[model samples]
Target: MQPNFFIILSPAALEDLPATYMTSFFLPREEKRFLNRLLSEFPAITVIEIDAIVEQIQSIVDRVTQAVELVLALVVASGCLVLIASIQASRDARMREHALVRTLGGARSLIRGSLAAEFAVLGAFSGLVAVVGAEVTVALLQSQIFELPANAHPWLWLLGPIVGAGLILAVGLAGTRRLVSSPPILVLRGTQ
Candidate 1:
């Protein structure tokens, strides 16, 4: 029976053989034609090309990349869902505090703005810490592992805070819209 797989012999090893051998070379697009001609003429020769092997490897890489992207999407979606759930869980306490502020003569818009600003500041601070940690980690990896120069992107530091703040503010407000809009009396009375 024919084996399901075959071991590939290196060119160096094959060249050491003590028998007469024939080699054929073909241009890029003439591989199939040459392969067909050889199969018809010799009936036992095998054909393979560097380009074909490289193409197969590239296809595998593309599949792995697609799988990584799908996993990343799932992780991000789950993180957002967790964030929303946590905010919802804290709604009652947040409403009580907001009610107290309102009862103490704070304007409704002021309370909402303050909460948004607070979340944004927290996000910005967290982003700054994250950037610092990432910079240090990358620096270590580059210098020790890869033996490369450490590169820093100043724009990333600047943009990180803004992006973090904007995202947190948007998500926080979206998740707490009801708590932010309800009047102090209704919130205190637990009527809405």
Candidate 2:
């Protein structure tokens, strides 16, 4: 019986078919000459390659990647700004604690190190919560809305806390630059 529709076959697989009804031609480094001859001989035949289809898929993937990166950058920028504002707002309380530490003869390095460690811990805690929340949300969406199998990314567990701590430390330190530079007495005098 005649086939209902023609199945596209790869050029590489042409050799696998029997030579009775199927005609296989090989023209080394003369694809243009071969195509010209084939079309002239059988102008009604159609030849299609998967390259165009694969290129379309690749283009879609690239666009998705770019959109994801843009979104991630916006989120990180906004998070940093929020972090900076929070730290700056709590500056008075921090200054009082630092002044107390200084009165107790705490060294400059000690105070700075303590602040850095505190911020790092805060960041790690925040990251841990965020990761857990995100994982749960994604799992729910996958199982309920999308009806797909949900999988966890193990790297997120490790990376999230580390990145969070680093970002918090960086932004917190930058926000408290004035407090870091000023003497405790000066800060206590309300002139800072």
Candidate 2 has its poorest 10 consecutive residues by lDDT at 19-28
Among all candidates shown, the one with the greatest lDDT: 2
Candidate 1 on 36-146: residue-level lDDT in tens? 776799876666676788899999989998997899569546756777898889888999999999899988898889889888996687668767876998799899998
TM per prediction: 0.64, 0.69
Clashes of 2: 0
Off by over 4 Å in 1: 1-26, 42-46, 121-165
TM-score of 2: 0.69
- Kindly report which residue pairs in candidate 2 clash with one another: none
Residues 1-192 of candidate 2 have per-residue lDDT tens digits of: 234567678888887776434343444544556777877998877644345567998999899989978997898899899988888799898887888788788887888898799889988987887789879988998999989999997888999899889988888877877776678788778876
